[model samples]
Target: MSAAADFAQDRDTLHFRGDLSLARLGSLPDQLDRFDGRVSRVDLSAVSRIDTVGAWVVHRFAARHNAQVEGLDEDSQMLFDHVVGAEQPVAQAPARPNGLIRFVAEVGAAAVQAGRTMYGLLGFLGATTIAFLNVIRHPSRFRFNATVQRFEVVGVSALGIVGLMSFLIGMVIAQQGAVQLAQFGAEVFTINLVGRLTFREMGVLMTAIMIAGRSGSAFAAQLGTMKLTEEIDAMRTIGVSPVEALVLPRVLAAVLMMPLLAFYSCMIALIGGGVLVWLDQGIPPATYIQRIREVVPITDLYIPLIKAPVFGAIIAVAGCFQGMLVESDAEQVGNRTTAAVVQAIFMVIVIDAFFAVFFTWVGWV
Candidate 1:
């Protein structure tokens, strides 16, 4: 039968009695943890037998109290010495900071990350500018065939969906404007509302959003895949400038086609609004068209034509920047593609707002 381990303190010495083996440890380890008193010495004379585990516990308790360990047999003394030599403190997890501190730290980290992202994007823009300059200097470096293919991909292929969305959006706007204007006996003004809104803002804005999601994501995914396959690396090795070969063609196509797409979107939206006007207000399509011509100024057309190419450039640049940043795996390609769409859309909206304010200030409102 094994004797249970026990401990007591007296004469400023902690005495451990009974068999101090691991099986008999019981609550002694815990008691040692809770033990409090002046301990000048550890008396294990009464300890019947001790295992390595028991020797470790005794040695630790003695060290914690800075007490001298005494009354050990030769074997126990050797075991205690080994335990002492082997002792090493374990690493503990850091304590958590309070909420306010953590919040500040997180915000600071996010701000720093955003600054870095802006810096990288600006750097990429500068590099693209230099590449474009080089292409201008050597017109033969301009890849006309690649630009043609990208035109089909980014512009022509997107026409159906973009046109359909514009039509539906225009119908909704006309119907809603008609409903509100009917209350004022000004239902005819729905023509002006739909015409001016679509031509000046919604046409290009919605097209930009669509392009960011469709073509921007495609750019990121395509470039990301090329990077993953090391094809971009191979091209670089062969003296091919990826910016000119890949990025420029996409960027040029987007810039050239955006105006055309926006114009198409505006016309389709006008037709959609004309249809709604005829059905809802019993106004004839010709009359609705005439009213739109009278109410919507030439300045309305200037806005989209001015903004479309910039929006296109922003979308392409954002997509290519995110794509170039992608690394490691297919998962990162998907992530960068998502980031590209979000960044492109966000920038488009922000830039559009600034343009709106500027146009208003310039009396184009």
Candidate 2:
């Protein structure tokens, strides 16, 4: 049978003997842990067949008591040195900060992030402007086919849904207006309300929101995927300007399509309102059309026409900007796509409000 490991203490020194392998040194570990007496040195001259586990135990004991180890063979000494070198500090949890302090810190971080995002967006806008100027100088660089394809995607394909939604919204507005006006015996004024509201605000605003959700998200996802697959990098290597090749076409399509789409939406909505007015109040379609022309101002039509292209540009730019910034994994593509839709819609609404105030100030109200 193999001899068991043993240790004896003489004053400030410890003398160990026999095999110092893992299983053989079982009780020696427990003894070292239980003993609390001073130990200045450990003598291992008689030790035989020492292994890594045994060396670890000896090293821990010497370290705990500030003791020196001696009489080890070259192999055993190397093993002990490896164990000592492999030590790591234990981690401790940090204390929580005060609630108010945490809240202020969060607000400060949010403000800083917003400032950085604004800065990046402005830089992207400048780059797009430069690309536009370059394309203007060299008209041959424009991608006619790509822009046409985007027109189909961003405008023609969206008509059915946009028309349906505007039709429903117009019906709702006329019905509600009739209900309120009936009490005052002013049900005929519902036509004026529908015409004015849809032409000036709802037509372009609703179309902008729809396009943002549809085309803006699509732009971000497409470009983000290209970025992930290094297609954008390939374009750069081939001396192709990504902004001119991809972004300009999409933005131009949106800008050209939005006014047409908004006008179509307004006309469809007016038709729906006319249908509602005839069914609910027994008014003739002829009278409804004449009344709309008489009550709705020309300025109302111009408002949506003016706003549509701006809203479209914002949507396209926001989407392409988020997409070009994408990096890392497939998950980032999805996140950037969502960010694009949200950013476009928010900017559209804010601009819409500003337009409202400006127009009101200029006597367009």
Candidate 3:
């Protein structure tokens, strides 16, 4: 039978009967309002069975009316006591601080997070340096095969896209600079502008940005996946230094490949600019070539070579650092990969700017 509640006005009692379980709770009184003032006692002698839900119902009714429960068997009373004992008030969260305090707190938290990220990147850089030193000390320990494989991926495979992008950028610079210089009857100077900019800054910067998007993100994703699957942890357990085996090869590969890539980029960009000038200004190829040779100094060529390896090292280190930071979450792979690209590009540009300032101070420009 379904459970029910009834008020016995004659005895000032609330009565429960039948199977008092969750399945039969619908048959109980819909409201306890009637028991508020009049009811002083509850009679549970006829309850055939009760569960936690049923016991809670009865307990609530009795508690509301300050009524005494009577005639429950030992089992029913125990169930009632257990259910009532388990009930607790839910705690509310504390209120947030108002206005400026909240804003300041958030800003402070962001600053702290940034500081931690900087500290972590610096630590990873140190570890990678130690790994590099170890490899240098024992050439036999160097992962030459792995480094060569990475070189193919980071350098050889990247040639087409980098070449295409550098070419387009060179054409744009030529078109814009030629149009402006034409006003001053100096349109021929486009060759000089293209040669110097491509070699000294644009070619290498573009290549670094591309490499950061490609190789850096790949490094982060690869390492982050290894981290997610506990492969990195397993390597540690087996006494394999992941930093030496994994990171050193990638960094070395970047260092080896970046200068070569940058040189290719500069050549392709200059070729693109030369083609554009010939087509647009009707300048002969021989004259353009001679002009570039005469106008662009050897120092411009050497500066990019110096910047390439440093930019490559920065990209590899930033990527690997973010990769090692991945927690056990799979979503973190994408996040860290994105972070790697952003960190590498940001650092690349900052370093490039600093180099510009230093070289300018030394009169290299």
On TM-score, the candidate that comes out on top is 2
Candidate 2 lDDT tens digits, 317-355: 999999998999999999999999999999999999999
Index of the highest-lDDT prediction: 2
**What overall lDDT goes with each candidate model?**
0.93, 0.93, 0.89
Query: In model 2, which residue pairs have backbone atoms overlapping below 3 Å?
Result: none
RMSD of each: 4.8, 3.7, 4.7
* Model 3: per-residue Cα lDDT over 1-365, one tens digit each: 45443334446877777777887667465656444557788888877778888788878888887888887788878878888889899999989889799999999998999899899989999999999898889888888899999999999999999999999999999999999999999998899899999998999999999999999999999999999999999999999899998999999999989999999999999989998999999999999989998989999999999999999999999999999889969899999999999999999999999999998998988
The parts of candidate 1 lying over 4 Å away from their true place are 2-22, 26-104
Better of 1 and 2 by lDDT: 2
Model 3 clash pairs? none
Q: Rank candidates, lDDT, best first.
A: 2, 1, 3
Q: Which ten residues in a row have the lowest lDDT in candidate 1?
A: 1-10
Clashing pairs in 1: none
Q: Model 1, 85-145: lDDT tens per residue?
A: 9888898999999999999999999899989988998898888889999999999999999
Q: How accurate is candidate 2 locally (lDDT)?
A: 0.93
